[model samples]
Target: MTRYTPALATALAVLLPVSATADSFTATIAAGHPPVFRWIRMISDTFIPTVTAELEKSGHTITFDEQYGGALAKVGEELEAVEAGLAELGTCQSLFDPAKLAVQNVTYYTPFVSADLRKVGEVIDSLHADLPAMTEAYGENGVVYIGAPITIDDYLLMTNFPVESLADLDGRKIAAPGAAINWLSGTGAVGVAGNLTTYYNEIKTGVYDGVLVFASAALPGKLYEVAPYVTRAGLGAQYAGSLCANADWYEGLPDDVKAALKTGADAARDWYTTELETAVGVSLEKMAEAGATVTNAPDAMRAAWAKGMENAAAKWAAELDAQGKPATEVLTTYMEAMRAAGATPLRDWDKE
Candidate 1:
């Protein structure tokens, strides 16, 4: 038991009248890939800084726990991790998580459409904001879109041997990511499900003869050392993933904090697309200088390659539509948007 005096009581009264204001927030940002990738790098370089700056204007601060290289989540598992609250936010790779994000893979199913990374990134980001259907999967997974769209540059075939024609791919073990594997149909090539992380070693060790990869990644991965023949077959740029936050965690944030996150994401998107646009040309040039033989497929060969493949888009849309996913609608909308933006697709995936 203790005695309470007037001075002690006054001191306690003065010290205990604290306000219940939250001036800070803590977030854990996860990515399956390491910071070597431009998209991952932008998280640290652009997204975090932009968010911090915006929050500071309103007398708020945020602390971010950056997790990359599968330290927190592996590729295709980020969405689940965020949904389960293992992380507050992550890059939800729709391209890899095709079953969960079927509608998000519309671009992959409809290849040979556009190679413009800027256009694809802008259009896809717009869709995410303007189209409720675009974000339906996120809601189902207990996550919400936070932007920072990842637009892969034009995909090219990098093989150990020269590919002057489609016949060169016959019987060869070629690797592609996710839905893009379907592009191998009617090409006579064996399409192995592979990713950028294992492409260099797999190809070098004879596990794969070649890979359908993009230049921006090929240069950093040094795939030229293994598969030196790079053929620009015009598979087109792709919307692989985007930033997502745990629905509960995001909703709990203050309005200003949420606005800051959006601002950060928009800044990151602009930075990423500009960097990717520059990287495509620079990566190809560097790979060529490093002894990789680079060639563009002939017009006839490109046309034949596109014509030979099965209508994967129609099949994919039909399958998802049967499952009650708005894949067909998303596909049609994407194609219309692309066409309206001046893209001349080799095949009308939605119309046909």
Candidate 2:
């Protein structure tokens, strides 16, 4: 025998425990959108590969049972669907879950904080590090936020009407999805219910005159196929969605698997962001070449709207505070960071 000693045996025993501790877990992710959509690919392909690869590297195995394109949940019910433990995880747009995911909308209230999706995304991710209070809001409904926060590309105005100034926007039927309608509040533009999917059709049918949509999603969605006037209103992108997990499912996961999933989530966030950032430029070019009339919203209008947001921000913050969520902190942190980053608010619709 080479060496049969207690000290050597003890060393081997310790290494054995270390090696034995690595294990894998199976995670199921849910999405209500098609796999071809960029959002879906991030979750099903990019996130899956990144996380599973990380787990395997760390001696953990991760298998995903993915449900996309509403195979598991309806389009708008992702928050509830995830919370009810239907699927282990899903991508949810906070704006869509107004009652449940109210806390995540803090940055949306403080507009122009970041036109750069990546920067806004970083702040949100950093804030989400230990947002148990925020999570508790989700947890109360049986959902948990894991991995990364979801940030959207900047909201641009693709309109049937020409808007160079606030005056041009007066009395026009403005189709704004979610809280973005608040952005058009006082301009005499009627806030109609329209999301990216419906905007182009609504425009074609004369349901609304214009749309507030992001280039990343809209270009792929081809909203310009209906609306010809695409104005670069330059409303900063919002941190609009999140990667949410089923609390019960998450708790059931092994520690190593949980860590692997988180690693995967980070990879997915970066991948989604990279695609979003690239899409913005590319979408605009395609829209421009396709005969969409494009122009920048005037500085005066942007300044005017920025001034009006005070009351809206305060009201939105207070709403969150009443719910016992850290809305004020989230809002304040975002506004301060954006200001520090040289962000000037575009419009002040909350002002009288």
Candidate 3:
């Protein structure tokens, strides 16, 4: 046992008192989707635990009240929920909130770039850090951008009928989500705007012939049941959503709490991406085992589809420029970054 002088003991008591009272905060995190979705699940499985662990190191703690599966907000309402303080944090789907987060939907317009979900996620997350415009967009909507960007695996077309070429899609009704509807332009396919939740019922009732979706979701949603034909169109992976915090709430957080949240986002991104990559392969195999006809769209057909589509990316960027946003600059920067990372895009949206 070590003995201390009265003066030394008094100094120790003073210093110990500082951390004795740990600041505790209550945060409500909401998501439109259920915990079945990988990203939403990670918020609990990875993010909350990681942040809790990190905060403990600094003698701070946060208790998260999870509200997922539309218990707090409906699909496409997460951003608003967070902005209005209905939820302190949320998974904001930029794909759904195109009018509010147009820039964050860049990957949707720039298709055929790369199929690497990890690369797409990291690149977009990096943009949020390097480009003030990226974060500023979220700020304008009353949210602080967190680092983890929820990216999906490569997109494929699932149809009731087989599609071996673009011609097959001619006069066929194809359901696409939000900005992805533009991808059907000049391909002779009639593009109807749709979302994942309605894909099953719509296709089952012939509301539409099929949908443009990804493997991870398609498998779980049992989209293969309605649309048995899976054409790997290589439309490219995409960054659809992100974790964000209410700006006002985030600003009032203790410094250590903020740091822990940031650190948690970073770790969650890594874990989520790895799990996603593994799930993609497994999901595809499972779909095939369930008797879904899975085929890789012929290279020539893919090239034709890319060449035939109208330059929606250019048009989208121009619209943003007209709105006084750095759309063109972002397009260029994104393409350059993709190329630098060894991505060989079939169509350089900015250049052509």
Candidate 4:
């Protein structure tokens, strides 16, 4: 080959480096919930910022377009939106899509495990990594499961009337989110499927006498104004949502870019967990300050409630098992992992 002139070589070198440098990418992340929700807020506050910083270290950068609070997808529509490429990433509320992402609702089925939110989240995320079926559910929906699962604090019974025992809930209507309604089985409470957004209005209007809600959400929704009696039932923490990315889009990313996104998700998990932990105490205090009656259900009542309930977890796993899904495997793995992590479950759904 003929040697290039000095000027030509200089131009070629400049062009070569420019071509070799990673191209910037733009990803749009969506969330159905508003920024007021800690999990959603962490997307902008921690995930985006952390991702930006991590990619910069590799000489690659990404510009994230945040669409939250139903701007792009309404509640329960995030998975479809991401799969259809409406959003490159989003918060997929598995609780809202139990029909499609059935195994992801394990914690909701197995209650009274533990109130340690961080442990619950960590265990579920680990399952997603360790189990093929866990991630396969997302792959089947054309989404990639990011490791950070959104976990909520312990569930409690918020009511207009005092609830010291399971007897207090007899014939009472209680609003509960999907899958969680099963928690009311054998407790004599009529479970009505409801969500946080409508809890206040429904309770105020007497559509339901009470709601199965967590403190972190109740304070923001101002549910105390309507259901002033709060009973800490210790119904257990839950993993209800996760950050996911469009499978095609995620697979097409450069390795470094992909790593950055995962790093961001990991960081967001810690941030969200810390924020949620802090918020729980603050929310309960705020509710109590707002003239709400907050009391802990006695140990006897908590035990009675657990024993009285139908084994929804076992039934749920068996149904999925019949469908040829590894539901029992996942259930066993999850319950074992929880116990290994120092959780003393009220009932071992997998074994029982």
Candidate 1: Cα lDDT at 108: 92
Task: Give a tens-digit lDDT track for model 1, residues 167-216.
Answer: 98899999998788988888899999998889999999999899999998
Pick by lDDT: 1 or 2, better one: 1
TM-score (all chains, Cα) for each model: 0.91, 0.88, 0.94, 0.93
Q: What TM-score should be assigned to candidate 2?
A: 0.88
User: What C-alpha lDDT values do all the predictions have?
Assistant: 0.92, 0.75, 0.90, 0.91
The window of 10 residues in a row where model 4 has the poorest summed lDDT is 13-22
List RMSD in Å for every model shown: 5.6, 2.9, 2.4, 2.9
The lDDT leader among the candidates is: 1
Give the Cα error of residue 245 in candidate 1, in Å.
1.0
In candidate 2, what are the lDDT values of residues 87-112, reduced to their tens digit?
Answer: 77888768777677787787667665
lDDT string, candidate 3, 156-188, tens digits: 899999998888999989999878888888789
RMSD of 1: 5.6
Ranking under TM-score, best-scoring first? 3, 4, 1, 2
Off by over 4 Å in 2: 1-22, 130-132, 308-310, 346-352
